[model samples]
Target: MNNSKKANYSIKCTVENCANHCGKEQYCSLDCICVGTHEGNPTMDQCTDCKSFLLK
Candidate 1:
């Protein structure tokens, strides 16, 4: 993947530690992302997680 490419403005992100994160922009490089929850019955944002996140 071209990690140096411009950010996908539609997918806003702040996790610079993610491999898909645009190096200098606060956005995700991917065209889309997957969101999932760790809890069986998620009721809050904290209970959810970014399933597409990968360690940089």
Candidate 2:
């Protein structure tokens, strides 16, 4: 039996202010890329802020 637990991986920003659509390895827009860097979360894989984040 497999006892290993599967990791629920998902993209998430650290800015806490941005609302961009972060995917497993992609951002919704370029703005999110900039903001993610400014917010000290430069990790492209883990975006947290984005200027082009649309609130829907």
Candidate 3:
């Protein structure tokens, strides 16, 4: 028998007002996140934002 657990990335986040924020650790509790752009296309990093962000 094998007993193991999958690793979950501890993503450091600064969005304090976001619902995913992990208390005072400044980390995101969500297993994964989604990013989307308002232009319907992405050509630059600034063109995207965390669509998963939910106001606390």
TM-score for each predicted model, relative to the true structure: 0.88, 0.21, 0.67
Scored by TM-score, the top model is 1
Mind giving the per-residue lDDT tens digits that candidate 3 earns over 1-56?
11132223467678878767765666677788887887777788889898889888
State each model's CA lDDT, in order: 0.89, 0.38, 0.70
- Clash pairs of candidate 3? none
Q: List the residue pairs that clash in candidate 2.
A: 13-47, 13-48, 14-48, 32-50
lDDT of 2 by residue, 1-56 (tens): 11232222343443323334433323242322334445553556455544455553
lDDT of 1 by residue, 2-56 (tens): 4666799999999988989888788998889999999999999999999999998
Range of the 10 consecutive residues with the lowest summed lDDT in candidate 3: 1-10
TM-score of model number 2? 0.21
- Whole-model lDDT, candidate 2? 0.38
Question: What's the candidate order when arranged by decreasing TM-score?
Answer: 1, 3, 2
